[model samples]
Structures are given as C-alpha cells and as structure tokens.
Target chain A: MSIMRLLLVEDNARLASLIREGLDRQGFAVDWCESVAGAEHALKINAYDLMLLDLGLPDGEGLDLVRKLRRAKLMLPILILTARGGLDDRVLGLDAGADDYLIKPFQIPELAARCRALLRRPGASLGTTLIVGNISLDTAERTVMVGGHTIEATPREVSLLERLLRRAGHVVAKPALEGALYSMDAEVTPNALEACMSRLRKRLNAAAADVQIRTVHGVGYALFAPVSTDG
Target chain B: MDKAGNRKTGPTGPTLFRQIALRLSGFTLLFAAMDVAIVVVTYSSQPESLAQELLSLEAERVQSATDTDPDYLAGPPGADRWSARYIDDLGEIAGASVGSANGGRLMDWTRRERIAGGYRITGVRSVVRHGKQHWLLMQFEGDGIRPYAPVILDEIVQHVAVPLIPLSTLLLIFNIVAVRRVLKPLRQAEAEVDALDPDNGFHRLSEVTEPREVNTLVRAVNRALMRLDEAMAMLRSFTANAAHELRTPLSIMQLSLDRLPPGEVRDELQADTQHMTRLVEQMLDLAQADALAPELLEQVDLADIGREVVAAMAPKAFADHRDLQFACHGNTIVLGHAEAITRIYRNLIDNALKHAPGQTAIDVIAGPGPQLSVRDHGAGIADEDLPRLFDRFWRKDRRKTDGAGLGLGIVQKLAQVHGGTAMVENAADGGAVFRVTFLAAEPAKPA
Candidate 1:
C-alpha cells in the first residue's frame, strides 16, 4: 500500500492537528481545514483519495458536506467524524453519502485501519473467499476448515462463525453479531454470547487453527490473524 | 448568641418576627400595668389629702371667730359639724373667747369648733392664757353648711384628676401605636418567608424599605440564593462536560464499527458498540435527568411502558434461552414520561436476563406503585449488594462482563424522575426482584 492523501476538515484546530500528526506518522498525508467552506475550496483546488470530516463545524456539519459531495457526484471516500454517536446520528451519517464514520478521540491505529479499509473498499470484491494464512471459511459451502479438518458447528453457530471468518483481522462489535444470530425470534444475553463464542473458539482451536479469537475489553471482538514468526 | 450573649447573630430558635412581637406585647403590657398602678395608688389616697385640706380650712375659720372677739363668737361661720374640748384652764384664742360645737376634755385640746349654737363655752380652742392651767377650748356645734368635703374634693379633682386622666390615656395610645408600628416590618418579613417556594420559586425577600430589625434576614436570604444559583450553574456545566467527554468516545467506537468487515468481526464490533452505546446513553440520561425542569412533565402510563419494555426484551431473552413474562394490575396508569418508565423496564429486564442462566424464568409486574416487581430466576443479589446495585458502574462481581454496568443505575434515575423509586430484593421463592413504584393516583370516589 502507498501513502494516500487525506483531507481532514475539523473546526477544532487542536484535535485536527493531533489527528493529522498521528495519521502522518501512519504514512498518510493529511490536509487539514477548519470549516466546510475551506474544505469545499480545498476539494475544488486539489485531488485527494479520501476526506476525513468532523461533523461539528462553524460553517456546516460533516454530514452536509457528504450530502453536497454526493449531490456533486464526487466519488471520493468520506468518513464522518462526530461526537454525537446516537443511533439516529449514525444512520444519518451513512444515509448522507458518507463512505464510513468515526467517533471522536479515536485511536490512531483504529482510525488508520478504517481509513485504509475504506480506500480499499471500492476496488475490493464483495464475493471473494476471505482467507488469512491457511485457515479458510468457504462462503460457497459455509464451512470452516484448517489443514483439511472440517470444523463442525451448529447451523446458527456456523452462520455466526462464517460472518466473523469472512472479515478476519477486523474488530466486530456485539450488536452486529446479535443482528446476525437472531431476527426477532430470540433474545441473547451477555452470558449466552460468551457461551456461543466459547464453543466456537474451542471448535476452531480443536481444528489446530493457527489463529485465535481475542476479546477487547470494554469493546467487542478482534479476529487475530496469526503472523509468521520469522516476519 | 451563645448563653454568654456574644453578638447574638444569625437566625435564633425563634424567628425575628416572633421576638419583635413578644417585645412589642411585653412593653405594651408593662405600660398598661404602670398606668393601672399609678391610678390605683393615687385613687386609694385621694380621700386622706382631701380630709386634711378640709381640716386646715376649719382651723382657719376658728381663728377668724376668736379674732373677732369672744363676745362675737356666737355662731360658727358656715357652721356644720365641729369638735371642741374643755380645758381646766382655757387657752386664749390670742385673747378672744371661743365657743365649740362638740368636744371632749382629755387634756390640752386641738379642735376646730363651730360657734353658731354656743355661749362662749371655752371658745374655739386656741391657747390657754389664764391661771396656769393647760386648757383646751370648746366650740358651739350646729349643722348649717360644713363647707369642707365637697369644696376641697372639688378642688382636688380639678387639679389632679384632670392632669392624670389625659396623661395616662395619652401614654396608653402611644404605647399601642408604637408597638403596632414596630411590628409591621416583621409581619411583612414573615409573610415573605411564608411565600417562599421549595423549587426555586423565590430567591430573596427585598428589604429596601424594611425595618433595621430584619435587614440581616434579607441579606442572609440573598446570600443563600446566590449560593444556590452558583450550585445550579456548576451542576449544568458538569452535565455538559460529562456528556461531551463520555459521548465522544462512545460515538467513535460506534462509528468506527461501521463498514466493519461484515462477518463475525463486525458482529463482535457491533456488540462492543452496543455496550459502549448503552454506557453512553445511560450517562447522557443521568446528565439530562439532573437538569430536568419538572414543568416539562407530561402524563404517561407506566404499565404500558413496562409492557413495551418487556416486549422489546423478549427477543433478547429467547436468544439467551430465557423466558420473560409480565403480569400487571390492569390499567396501572401513572403520570410521568413514557420514555423514563420505558428506561426503567429496559434496565430491569436487561438486568434479569443478563445475569440469569439460560432457560430461566423472568417475571415482570406493573401495578399501583410498590406492587411492581421484575423477578428473575437468576442469582439474587446479597442483602449488602442490594444497596449498592443502583450505584453507577457498581456490579457485585468485579469481573468485566459483556454488558455495561449502568443499566440498574438508569432504572433508579428514571424512578426518581417519575417521583417514584426503584429497589431490589431477593424473592423468597428464589429469584432476584427489581421493584419500581410510582405514587398511586388517588382512587376515584363514587360519583
């Protein structure tokens, strides 16, 4: 991956500068602007791969910019940054033509990962068999396998694992998992979730898989793709 | 003031209004008593003074009689009743004979005699001047006009009664008026205090035109209002700051999860997002609740909200292999916001299902306050843990669980906002019970 140019529009100079500095260290060139007007002018004057926008601005909200960009039919990736993470706000951000969204005070790595992933999205295949190393979950068969051993799973458990196996090395939150598990038929408890994950993790480990599922405290799950020790 | 009466500052046990009233009435009573005492003592002795004056006038009349010559002393002037004494040797009325009206001889005599019906019988007593004898005088006696009792009494009344009557009456009127005038400000201050509202209705009683006695009170009230205003301002700022700090990270975590590699990874991210969202929302709710103005209140049904929450939680319960059931006292309506009651039920059900083992029965009840309880066949909280359950982020086990710790705290907050309360206890039949209660509306009487 080459260094990508990012346009960061945020009214708060301190946070914008900090994010820019962090992203710069992460090998992305960030052009910072203080308002929507500045951002619009910058977009007209230059070409960029992605735009990072803070929704709180003196001139306009980030969502409004996303809307305007969408109306103008600009194809650049727009990630909305907002302090209000309300459900309606999240829905509104995505609905307004934002390619992705991030909440404030984000970790440099998480922000970087999202930015990289969003840039990669347009060129990626939706139907590709997601693979990391030798452990493979075949979408066609909805079966998980590591080194020729078929992993046995309940139909629901298979579905749950299939969703995770398809997106290896990304953080998955709980509600997203809930949506996939049951559709208004059953309610799941935290304990139930723990139980499901425990059984799933054991099944995967039993197949002598190289990777493991990691729990992120106060957050959700991380599918860790094992790295070659010699790296 | 202390027992030593040092400065005597601040509000006393008795209000200043009462003290002033007591003082006013005390002075009024004291003045009334003094006026009465003066009237009684003077009234009791007036007769003695009048009698003395009358006697002196009679003595002068006797002198006049003797001075006119003993032969001329035939009858008393303004004759009435008089006394006389006969002496062994007659004392001269300065060389004139005297007559007495009535007398008794004991020794030397002191008498005022009437000469109207007398023959020079020892004359009106004066001094003896013959034959070395200490004599008293006799006087003739008759009833014509005594001229003493009425005349002298008239003079006394004309002088003393006229002066004392106006003085006592003026003092009494002045005392009453002064006492009442002094109490006017206190009465106004008391009325102002009574008019105060517990929910910030009034700040201070204006005392620009009030008496000096209550100026301290006005100033104290003003200071208290200032402090209250400062406290409220601080609370508002705290709410805003907390909301900003807490909501920002939660939003970030949630937003970052979007476009998450859609599969198990995304699913885990979504769970994290939900946990973070729940925490953020609970914090926001707490902040909003503290700043709530009661005037924004609207009528809402707790029972309906309870049912709605139970419905919402049922899917989650089924996912966890738990059964959520609700029994209600039908039509259990209360006046409050539906969302708050909904939050109460959400937290209660979330709590019950979160902790309970799979396939356990969870029962929810809504009724006329105190009767509503959410029963979970989960591990019941210990007696000691029950008190701390409503505390924010306080879980009985320190183990970091998949769920946020703010659920029950939100329930308690909603309960407070509804003018009700929430509590938890272990059921006798083996379960944890969460009970929310609103004040039951008074039952309608027979029409």
Candidate 2:
C-alpha cells in the first residue's frame, strides 16, 4: 500500500528538514518546498494528500498562492503555518481557503498529526477512518465510537475534534480551533469558544491518561500525542 | 531650508515651502516698485524738453502765416472761446491746451480770459523796426497744444498702468495658483510617505512620479518598505514556528518538574517556569504590538477600558500593598482601538504600582476632556529622570522594580498609535502624573 503523501512548505531549511525527517519517522512520505514557486511546481508534478503552507514564502505571497491553488480546483487540505497574533490575518487566511492554520515554530509531532488529519479528510485518495486507540471516528458519517460506546457530539465539536485528533501532538490556537467549531459564516466569540473548549477538555479528561490537552497561555490550546516524550 | 534639508529624512510642515514662496513674492513686489519708479523718472525729465519742441513748431507756423498774409494770424469774425481755430481758418491755426510751463491754459480767440480747452496760448510781445516801419507784434504760444501730446502720452501711460495693476494682481494670483499646482505632487508624496504603516509592513507608495529630484527618493522609500515587509514576514513565521516548536520542550520541562510533586526543586522549577511563561508572554506581546496595524482607527472608550483594568487589577493591587482606584467622570470617547486603549491603561496602572513607594495608593482618573491622567501618591520621579522615563528598556532603578521597564514605553507607543499625546508632570501633591490625551473625535457636519 502507498504511504501518505505530505507536502511541507517551510522557508527555513533546517526546520523543514527536521519536520520532514520526523514525519518520515511517523510513517509519512514527505516532500519539502521552500517557496511558493517550488511548492507550485511540486504540487503540479505530484498529488499531495495534504499541503502544509507557511504564510511567509520567499517567492510570492503565501496567501496569494493559497488563493491560486483553490482557484485551480485543488481541494487538498491546506494547513496554514503562521506566527501572527492578529485574529484579522488568521480570519483572512482561513477565509481565503485554508482548512486550518498552525502558528509558526510548531512541534513536529503535531505537524505530522495535522498532516494525517488533513490526509484523512474525505477528499483524500486514501479514505481512512481516524482511529485513536479503540475510539474510531468515521469521516464519511462524522460519527464517533469508543469501545462500542457511542457518544453524540454537536456538529461543531465533531469538526473541532477531527482537527485535534488529526494533529494530536500539536497545540492549536483558540481562534483556529474556533474556526473549525463553526463554518465559514458563523460568528464565534473568543469567550464563547473558550466555553466550548472547556467542554471538550473535560470530555477528553476521561482519556487524559493516554492523551493530554495543554494550554499555551494567552495563545490557543493544543492536543498532545500519546507518545509525546517530552511533553 | 530646514524642510528642504529634512525632505530627504521625511515629511515636513508647510513652513519651508511657504518661506521660499514668500521670498519669490517679495522679489515680485520689488520688481513692481522699480517699474513704477521708471515711469516717474521719465516723466519728470522729458516733459519740459517736449514743451520747447512744441513752441518752436507753433512759432514757425505763425511767422510763416503772418509773412504770407497778416490777416491769416488774426482771429476770425464772430469766433467764440469754444470754437476751434481750425474750424474758423480750417488750416492755418489749431486751438488746444498750453504746456504746464505756460500756466496750464486752454484755447480762446485773442487769448482774452482764456478758457481751458486741450491747450493754452502764452503771449510774448516784441517791437522791432523793419524797413523804417515800427511794428507792434504779439508772439503767442498755443497753450492748449503742448499739453495735448503729453496728455495722449499720459493717457497711454494711464491705460498701460491701469491694466498692469490687475495683471500683476492676476500674476500674484497666478503665482499662488501655480505654486500650489506644482507643490501638489510634492504634498501628495509627503502624505503618502506619512501614511506608510511601520506596523503593517505593507506600504505601497504609488506616488513615485514626483519631480526628478524626488523620484529617486520615493523609489528608495518603496525599497525600504519592501525590505521591511520581507523581514516582518520572516519574523512572523519564525515567531510562530518558534513558539510552537518550543511548546513541547517547555511543557516537557514543566511536566517533568510537575511530577517532582511540590518540593524545593519543584518550587524552583515552577518559578523558572513562570519566568519562562512571562518571557513567552512578552515575546507574544511584542510580536503582537509589532503586528498591530496602525490603521485600526476607532472611537474607543478609554474610561470604560480604565474601569475594566482597575477592576481587573483590584486583587493584584491588594496583594502588592497598593490601591488601584478609578475616578472616571463620563464617557471618554477617543479614537483608538479598544485593545490598545486597555493595554495603555493597564501598563500605566502597572507602572504606578511597580514604581510607587510601598503602601502608597495609585489613583487613575479618566474621562476629562479626552485626557486620562494617572496619578500615584508615592515617591515621585526625580526631575532628572522625567525626560527619559518613556524610553524603551529604560529603568532608573531596575533592581528596585519587578518589571522589564517596557510598561511606560508601551504606554508612550500606545499614545502615539492612537494619534494622541502624552505629557509628564509632577503634581503638587508629591506625585508623578502622566497624562495621556487621546483627542476626541471631531464631530462630522453636514455638507
């Protein structure tokens, strides 16, 4: 069977190489591009299960590229990697067609998890159910089962968790998580979304022994992988 | 001169542009005065000479007419004062005004009780023996005639001089208009340069087509903007990536320390963790402040933010042995972002608590004429330190304080960011009062 294809577009050579190597260790076949031009050519030549885009590309503007990619009918899940603190820019990036955004200087494990989650999205050539230990989530039906014990979640929670479980080792910001909680049109306050996060953190508490949710303080929250060695 | 010199550095007021224009206009007025002086000098010297020439011509004509026929020079029958001599004799005589030297007279027959026409006739009587006959001959000057030429000359001068006033007035107007038109591009370039957002890292100076001298200047500015945008973009990504990557190590460090279970080692570790947390928070705050778009102009309530900050700090104030109080009078509407406004107040309150003598109270009063003053009753600043108080990373006694000394600098930047101003003064009651004034939004009127 063909392994998952991940496209990591980061301008920093060292960081990109480190990420590619780590994702390779996690069973992902990784290809790295440093700029928008390289990324474009790479995307054209080979199909990617997921495209990890850094907003600060050297050649052309990353946002413009994301817009271009979407305009070209490329439905590959794009995860925007950015370091900006402003909600406005994040909103603009997501609105421009990024499925999710991870702030810069991300943990490699979380990057891999987000990559897998994106690859596991419905449009992925390889249709796979997300199985976190015994709990399995069906992307098609958007259903969840834990040891045959089914629990109903709000549509928003399902969407939010899908993104979290997909990038289980990384901390996600409240705003980006909030974007997943609602569709492109809905208005969710930082506080209201905080309330939902409270609910999700509590539910995940039962499985806290295997999985951990950590807060980055003033930033957003993050979900850690089971084998998160350092965290 | 100053603005022209600083033009390379940045934007300036109309002071220098006006200075040059004023000097040019002074030259114009000087030129006008010189033109008037020339007319007066030419008129004073030439009119007498011109009158003598007119007398000679009249004498020659009368002598010739007397020699040809004596009756020709005499007056016609029934001729009155107003009738032209040319109408009576038709060719031999012309009655007009006399010259100024001849008492400013006009024409009349026999020169009796001369009424002014266009000239005056002056009389000179001479007796001479011609071939044994003593003849009494009256030599008369056509008084009206001399004044006639210069009057036409004066009329020509008047016509020319009259239009020049309006023309120069028009020229003055035209000068002002022309200056304004030419300076338009320069002014536009200045405005665009002024509007460049250092925070956004996105400034497009489309006004590159300036005067040849400044075209390169605009190009240089755009280049600088390009460099800034690239650097900022890189910084943004680097910060984000670094923040994310460090989290695992940071959490692992915390988790490893957390598992040590509340002992000396753990306490030390926790303190270190908190310190790290503060560092992270600072980095994030600095990154945020850097990324803040200067274009976020809004009518924010400083008083409301003040109250909120004070209320939020109530617990911290009690712990620090200080009082955080708010004295807001009314809705203080100033144009700024809500977040920045809140941050400004928070920094001010934090600074007061951090610097004030222990057990002293800090009172913040907002909502007074677009100005928010923060007063602390404690050891006030020395006059020496007042000027440099707002400089970044500047602290008079860092050992005595528990901050990075960025609070006041942040406040100052906040003041500038909101199109406001800040002033420092020691209040009479032995305290340092920092007043931040965010000018109220101008009320828009109907067109």
**What TM-score fits each model?**
0.45, 0.40
| Candidate 1 residue lDDT tens string, A1-231 | 456899999876656666787788779999999998999999999999999988878987778788989999898988887776442456578889888877664667678878877865735324335565557776667777777777787766666666666555654555566666775348766576678888988887788878757653323454656655211
User: Model 2 chain B — which ten-residue stretch has the worst lDDT?
Assistant: B81-90
Report the lDDT tens digits of candidate 2 across residue range B255-370.
34544667788887767775564445445555565566667767667766676666556546655546566677665787777766777777788778877788888888886778
Interface RMSD of 2: 12.0
Per-residue lDDT over A1-231 for candidate 2, one digit per residue giving the tens place of the 0 to 100 score: 478787888787766666676678779898998998899899989988788887777787889999998999888889887655342566688899999877544556566656666665665645456666445667678876655566666777667777766755444555577778668347777576777767766665554335555554433455554443542
The global C-alpha lDDT for each of the candidates, from Candidate 1 onward, is: 0.64, 0.63
List iRMS (one decimal) for every candidate: 11.5, 12.0
Clash count (model 1, backbone only): 48
Q: Is the docking of candidate 2 incorrect, acceptable, medium or high quality?
A: incorrect
Residue-level lDDT tens digits of model 1 in B148-258? 335445455655456665765676567667767777776776677766654343457667454665677678777887788787767755765676667555544554564
